[model samples]
Target: MKSDVLFTSHATAKNGREGHVKSDDGLIDLDLTMPNSDSDKKGSNPEQLFAAAYSACYDGALNLVASKEKKKIDSTTTADISFLKDSEDNGFKIAATLHIEISGVGQEEAEDLAQKAHQACPYSKATRGNIDVTLNPKAV
Candidate 1:
C-alpha cells in the first residue's frame, strides 16, 4: 500500500470556520468563513476550495486519459459541491456533481472519457467511498 510520492503541498488554517488560511508558498492565502446565505462574508469556505481543486484535478485527469487513448480534446469541468447534514452521524457531509463538457466529441464519447477520468483522478480516488459524486458529461 505504498507508492512513490511525486509532490506534496502544505497549508495551515486557524480559528476554525471564521479565520485565516495560508499555504506555505503563499499562493493560497485567504480568509475563511462559514457558508451563509444571509450574511455578506468576504471570505472563502472549505466546500468552495474543494470544488475548485476537484474541478481542476478532474480536468487534468481527463486530459491525461485522453492523451493515453491517443485522443485530443478541449474540455471544461465544473464541480458543484454541496455541504449537507449527515443524519446518521449528526455531522456534516459533502456531495459533488461534476459538469464535464468536451469539445469535438459525441455524448457517448464524452461520457466515456469522463467515466474513465473519474476512475483515474486522484481526487476521485480519494473521495470514492467517502462521498457521493455524480458525473454529467456533455458534448459541446
Candidate 2:
C-alpha cells in the first residue's frame, strides 16, 4: 500500500550540531547548535525546527477535520517539544505537548476535533507509540 509522494523537501546540514543547515528552497538557512544555558550564540536547533513543523502540520490537520465536519474554526496550535533523557538507550529522546485553542466552539467539540486531527496528522502518525505526545484542546 504505497502511496505516491506528494512533495519532498531537501535540506543539508554541515558539522553535525554546531554548523549550518540550508534547504533547497533557501527558505530555511540557519546555524545549528545544541541547547545551552550559558552560551548566547544566535542559532537554531533541531528541536525548535521539529516543533515548528509539527505545530504547523497539526494545525492544518485540525482545519481539514473541521472543514470535513462542516464547522468553521479559528484555531491556534502550539507544540511544546521537550528533549528528555532516554534511560533505555543512554541518549536523548523527544516528547511533545500540543495545546490547541479553537474559537467559536465548545470545549467538548474542540477536544473531539483535536483527537480527530491527531489521527489525521502525519506527524502524529509518525511519532505514535515512539514518543510521548499529550493533547490539550480548549475552547477560547
Candidate 3:
C-alpha cells in the first residue's frame, strides 16, 4: 500500500553554517544552524528536528493506543528527547533518550501506555535496531 500522506523536504542552503527546511505545504519549516567548534549554536539543528518529530509521533501514538484501550487522557502529554553523540565513536553514532510525561495518570498506567505507544510509533519502528533509545515514562 502507498503512504497515507507524503512530505517533501526542500532545503535551500544546507551546505552552509545555517539553512532552513520547508515542506510543500509550509507546515514544516524551520531554520537550522550548526554549532561551531566552540559548541555555540544559534538556530535549530537536525537533532532538534529529530527530537521534535519523535515527540510528536510518540504523543500521537500514545493517544491512539489510549483511545483504543478505552482510556481517557484528560491532560497533556510531553516528550523530552535528548540526543547524545557517541564519545567513543566520536560522533559517528548517535544515541537518544526519551522521557515521556503523561499527565492525569498513575505511573503504572503511564508506563503501560508509553510501552504500547513505542511499539505503535513509526519513529520508534524506524529507529528500532538502528539506534539505542532509552525510554522513561513518567506520570505527572
Candidate 4:
C-alpha cells in the first residue's frame, strides 16, 4: 500500500520589496524579505520553514521506527532543529536535535531506537551527507 500527504502555501505581495505566505492550514504565515544581499541574512531567512518541516517529519519517522522495534513512544517526543550558516560558503547547514522523553524505556534501548529512527527518517536520509543531525534522549 502507498500513502501520501500534502501541504500548500501561497505568497502575495506585501510591499515594494516584500511578500507574505499563507498556508491552507494557517500554521505558518511568513514574511519574505531580503535581509541583505551580501550578508548572512539570505540563508537565515528560510530556516523557520525548514525547521518546521524537519521536526515534524523526524518525529513521525521516529514513531515508526520505534513501533518496528517493538517500542512505544507517546506524546513526549520533542525535536529542535536549528539552521546554521556554513562558514566556507554562501550556504546553510541544518542541525536537528531530537529529544525523546518517554517512560519504560532505558537509555541504551532508547538510543538504539533513535539511531534506527534517524536512519529511517526520510528527511534525515535525504540530507544526510548535506546536513548535521544530533539526537538527544531524556528518559522519564
Writing each residue's lDDT as its tens digit, candidate 2 over 17-133 gives: 788999999999999888874667779988899999999999999999999999999999999999999999899999999999999789999999999999999999999999999
lDDT of 1 by residue, 35-121 (tens): 784667789999999999999999999999999998879999999999999999899999999999999778999999999999999
In model 4, what are the clashing residue pairs, if there are any? none
* lDDT over C-alpha atoms for residue 33 of model 1: 87
Better of 2 and 4 by TM-score: 2
Lowest lDDT 10-mer window, candidate 3?
Answer: 74-83
Ranking by lDDT: 2, 1, 3, 4
Alpha-carbon local distance difference test for all models: 0.94, 0.95, 0.75, 0.66
Q: Which pairs of residues have clashing backbones in candidate 1?
A: none
Which digits, one per residue and each the tens of the lDDT, describe model 4 over residues 22-96? Answer: 565665556655555554433224555566677777778877877777787662555566656888897866676
| TM-score for each model | 0.96, 0.96, 0.75, 0.66
User: Residues 66-127, candidate 3, lDDT per residue (tens digit)?
Assistant: 89998878434444445556787777565667777777679999989989998999989999
- Considering summed lDDT, which 10 consecutive residues are worst modelled in model 2? 33-42
Q: Once model 3 is optimally superposed onto the true structure by TM-score, how far is the C-alpha of residue 8 displaced, in angstroms?
A: 6.1
